[model samples]
Target: MPSFAQILIALGAAGGALAAPFANTTAAAVTTEQRSAAQTFTGDITYYQPGLGACGETSSDSETVVALSPAQYDGNCGKTITITKDGKTATAKVVDKCPSCASGAIDVSSTVFQSLADMSVGRTQVSWSFN
Candidate 1:
């Protein structure tokens, strides 16, 4: 019942998917070497509402997302970063740019901030690194 053209198209799609790298995998694990090589930065961490980002992605405030300073944002879109505050750690993707943030400081989603410190604290000192 299928047309010859339709069959060929379906098979081509299947073959292309099979050849795609890590197409069948979920998140890739970051190697320890990559983690150790990431330079740690310390700064004041603050929270922000989310929407369309400087990286050209739309995100939710409930998601683990972060806005890095212009100095750290270029070429790092979609990269994951590990943030630490008072021994609490949360991993968030770099999704936006923080024009107001200082060189080392970062702006994170409300979700990321709440996970590490109480919202009442407003802002807190945190150390972070790309992962």
Candidate 2:
């Protein structure tokens, strides 16, 4: 015969097991949707570095612009933007604008470039397709 303590534990376990199904059903019934919002810009449209100031300051540090797909320009900045180069996809951000940027190209901050591509890489032939 089980001790009183053992019977209480067994009853507790059975109660927990019985509640598990209802708990799971309730949890599954709740719907969770992840939202992806786009970023909107309407100012002078420029980015600045630590000491360099605005887009144009140092000629040696001319900004680099990488062309992105139509989907890439969904106007999202805070969110991560996927960049693909040499069959490798890297995540970067839509930080700033390059007045000198070629058509369909986007100019990311040097910090962002360092994150997605190596510093020595200069410029990476990449394509961005965002959601």
Top-scoring candidate (TM-score): 1
Estimate every model's Cα lDDT from 0 to 1: 0.89, 0.47
The CA lDDT at 116 in model 1 is 95
Candidate 2: lDDT of 119? 64
Model 1 quality (TM-score): 0.71
lDDT of 2 by residue, 1-131 (tens): 88999999999999999999998877665532122223321111122342332333332223433222333334443345555555555455443344555544555556446655576766545555443
Those runs of model 1 whose alpha carbons end farther than 4 Å from true positions after fitting are 1-37
Global CA lDDT of candidate 2, please? 0.47
Q: Please give, for residues 75-124, the per-residue lDDT of candidate 1 as tens digits.
A: 88999999998889999999999999998899999999999999999988
Best candidate according to lDDT: 1
Backbone collisions counted per model: 0, 2
Error of 2 at 109 (Å): 2.9
